[model samples]
Target: MLDISKLERRWLKYKIKKILPYTLLITTVTILGFTIPFVLSNRHSSKAMIPLKKDAIKVKAPNTENDEGAMVLEPSMHFIESMDTPSTPITNTPTSSTKPAPTPKHSIAPIASLPTPTPAIAQTQATKAPQPIVKGKLTSIKRDDTAFDIHEIEDRFKDTSNPNLGVYIAKYHYDHGNYSEAYNYALKTNSINNSIDDSWLIFAKALVKLGKEEQAKKTLQLYISNSNSQAAKNYLDTLDKGGSK
Candidate 1:
């Protein structure tokens, strides 16, 4: 037999608004008092106070290096000369005409007709077929394209000491389906260094593409550990289902 009280309890607890009002926040000290997961001492023992050993706390203050100088931005004026200049002129001249006199005709040999000239040999031969333009993988990207090589981007991050370049490069590789390389490089580019949740997402996507199902599952689980992973967690559900869309 089903319990009657359980249904009533579930019904009464349906409104989250009702429960939210009861969850009042308490101080950290109060929280620490009751939340003793481990009881090291007997409850009946009177307080045994020992002098707290004062450890020398070394405070490492950030170097107060004054920024080099205030950026001196030059003010500029963009003067655009409008092309529609109004005043212009059009010129046309017509001159008067004069009449001339007539000339006499000759008889000669009318029976003799002019012979047609023989055609010349063809000047140009058929041009050979132009070679097809074939494209291969590029090794090193330049500043011009800002892309081409995965290593180039990695080197950029190395040169600039900017970890963000790794995120960009990893995303570029993952988006292009170079998942093996993406996953390989992602190991070096720590997810914590990039946008935490987003990097993990890209890593999961790369892992999925690389056919590392178990690793991808674990990666997604790590993502859901965050407080703000509602949407990511929903996506994780889809990934868990192996439902490729």
Candidate 2:
């Protein structure tokens, strides 16, 4: 009976050992199945709670030039400060070039503006007659007479080569403020006889009156060098001092 009991115990021990291994394996499988699902769910919940990193906020730089889609930027503090500051006022000083040019003391009058020589003077000089060699003073017009016939003198000048007539005409024209005619007549007289003091005087004076002072001075200088006239010297001195006559 003791041997039968021992054999029964051994059989029981073997069965327990085999059943214990299967029981531990089933318990491990069941625990792993439940824990795996729980861990997966917890991981998903933690990921959702962590707030997935959102796309970074993006901003483009502003463009100053013409761009309808571009945002307008406000002026900076420095620009605003510059606009508020007062600038220095510009002062224009009159330079030498800005000043009005000085008017010449002896300005030549335009031909149109020049005084009429005489009523018949223009008509008589219009058709120049042939000049002939003749002598003697022009007794037709007196030196003291203010209402002298200029036409007659012009006619006489055209008809004769008398230098005295030229002198008379030049002197008459000068006295009447007809400097152009005076210059012409004086030039003609000088051409005939340069030694005539009255002709030289009239020519020089006419030159100055007609705004030819330099030419007048040169002419006088030449005459003085040749003739050594005291009167011509005086006239040159007067011209240097800006005296017309």
lDDT of 2 at 88: 7
Compared with the true structure, all predictions reach lDDT values of 0.41, 0.58
Could you give candidate 1's per-residue lDDT for residues 1-245 as a string of tens digits? Answer: 88889988887787655666555443555676666533436432323332122111111111112311322222121100100111100000001112111110121101011011111100001111222333453222111122434455566656653434444455556544577766755555553353344345556667777777677778667657744555446556776675542
> Candidate 1, overall lDDT?
0.41
| lDDT by residue (tens digit), candidate 2, 92-202 | 101122242232212222222223343233323432233332345321211222233455656667666466667667766775678999899989978977876667877
Error (Å) of candidate 2 at residue 131 is 41
**TM-score of candidate 2 relative to the true fold:** 0.40
Candidate 2 weakest lDDT stretch, 10 residues: 88-97
